[model samples]
Target: MDESAIRTQLNDAGYALVQVEPRLQGLGSTIRPDVLAWAADNDGVLVPWAVVEVKHRQVAGHSAALRQLATIRDQLGTVDHYVVIDGEWFRADRGLRTATPISGPVSPANGADGVLQDVSLATSLIQERLWNAANRRRHDGQRLDSLELFADLLPGSLSGELVARSGHTVRADRDVLWRAGRRALTAFTSQDKNTDLFVSHPAIARAVAELAGDAISGTVLDPFCGTGEFLWAAADRAVAASRSVELVGVDFSSQMIEIASSLASAAPVPARAIQGNAYSELPTDVDLVLSSPPLGLRLPTQHELLNGTSTKDGDLASIDVAIRSLRSGGRAVLQISPGVTFRANGEAYRQFLAENVRVAALIGCPRGTVPGTGTGSVLLVIDKLPPTKTFVSQLGEDWEDQLSSGGAAITAAVAHLDDKTAKAT
Candidate 1:
């Protein structure tokens, strides 16, 4: 059904319909609300609760769900009851706190434009208002914090993981963090879905972990550990699998280290974040060295003055440092940018990878893998080959497929590479 018809049916149920599109007339060019609704008392002194949006399609509805939740959160200053109404679908979602789908698709004999759906949706909305009415009366802003926002935007599996990782401690109270995370997750659905918060995306993390295996025993280091996500996740999985793992994160950005430290403090395996260059000065004798370095962004410290654009000296230096830091039979997972994987000049790094390190896998991450960062990154699992003299050049498409294969392939590669190194030594 069209938006207007849906809006009309919901309005009948005491909803103050706000058309989010076409910018809500003379209010302002910017005052565009999908739907504006209010729950009133007998006196009707603008009873402070507003439900926004009458979403139609599923995809756009999901996006609208996040945007509206954020709007509801923002509108908390003026009104308390904020909701996104999806009267056309099988559910009528309501509330500023969480994006929940109420069963609203029962078809009645006299029902038109899905009356059962509308009624069910309305009923849930009313129930939600009742639940929040007392809280609003108490003026509890914490009641409608961002958890609703996150749940609205993020996928369920990812959200569950974030909640699990947040644990007990941190600056924000448990409820407050829960709310902010939920809000961010929900908002993430609408925000750039490509940027991964790391802890939130387990599928990708699991893929990386599978390759890591028993390769990480003593210490695992992430050179460009953004917010220490990989290290915390790695330790969590390792501990679960009965592997004793020590985690360390090194990043140039102090802000990232602080953030990573906060998350680590909440996790079972506490991680250490030191502000140092990944390439030049990494901790010594690490069992695993992993990093996702910055691409194109130049650093002045290691400038060799190669070309007009300077050079990616820091990344190159870090790669060299990571290699030397690893002990024999040690492994590393380099999260390489797509440009580094395909470009001709990248042949040097690829060759360096093939010769100095065993190319166990080269997993191709889909475009949207890293949220906020628009670069496609691949997981490059490498091990230090003893005698350090196997000179292999150029990898084919088979390299991609090799990484895509599961644990068995990785195990076989690690065993074979270890055997070859032993024989050579």
Candidate 2:
């Protein structure tokens, strides 16, 4: 039967109907369901009702259509009821139950638009999954087996393996799992506290990785790795370069750390996530460090901070930790608060940088690039050697546009820095 006829039946059955187009969002792939029906309250608030699939006529492969409907429900989530229409006959499947016939002429409410409602459904479904995952806790330190299952459902490169570590076997893909798990934690925590958790945007994360240079090899670390985005980006770059590197991520949030560990387990290279203070003793002699540490915090002294003994200015301290963690000629690409270049304590830090590290580049990021963070940020690249000509540039408000085009600004600056290094050498 035609879709209009199906819509009429649903409308008569008290549902607002709209056609759903296949579009990729978050973990869901492109899916085009014939129609979506919602039960609207008296105030016209749309509550998810059911998904409908319309087939022209009865075919021998009818079972495949039903399976496709089930996949849509699983990907879209929220709604559990689905209906399949073939010619004049209709079958409704509620959750895992068998499909049953509904006796009526299908009709849908006039002028019902499903686009806005579908967006709402997608957001609600993602939030629900994140909430459930955030609340689940394991006391025995066993690997998060559920995350391994989730990895299989997600797109891109991800897999898991149980490996021996610290006298026990653990899931190797914990850090890869963290890519999604940490987002859930961030969402849940943000809602609970009504505050923005300094989660880096994926674009910003990719830009930072690009700034680190694709030639990067050996060990890489993100001391204040919130959700392991930088580590993931670095891993992807290393894979593109056909180079093998070890990935290490550290974050104080146990939840964040757990997710990061799970995610790193699935990286193309050897990777591990640690739950510890960035101010504490970290792995030394690392080749590169890329991180966006939390801002608006103060610290007393760099010495006290590095020993994991001070929490005066965590923003500055994280940079100090990154600098100290690097090998003699290693590089660090850090996302720092804009104010770090002028604050009183920042002066001392700058003086330290001038005396020790080679300041490579400072790329300013536009405001709102970090979503909840209205404050602007800067990407600071430094090498553990004598000073060099510093290349500084503003990324403007369209920094995201630059990022989308392969972070041209950052790439050019890195190229200039490479030339400067070559001349100096």
Choose the strongest candidate by TM-score: 2
Model 1 C-alpha lDDT per residue in residues 235-254, reported as the tens digit of each score: 75677778777788888766
lDDT of each: 0.49, 0.63
Cα lDDT tens digits, model 2, 351-383, are: 767766788888888786554666888889888
Q: Which 10 consecutive residues of model 2 have the lowest summed lDDT?
A: 161-170
Q: What does the lDDT come to for candidate 2?
A: 0.63
Write down the RMSD of all candidates, one decimal each.
Answer: 15.2, 13.0
> Which residues of candidate 2, in runs, are more than 4 Å off?
1-31, 35-198, 300-311, 420-425
Candidate number with greatest lDDT: 2
User: Model 1: what TM-score?
Assistant: 0.48
Report the C-alpha displacement of residue 66, candidate 2, in angstroms.
18
Error of 1 at 275 (Å): 2.3
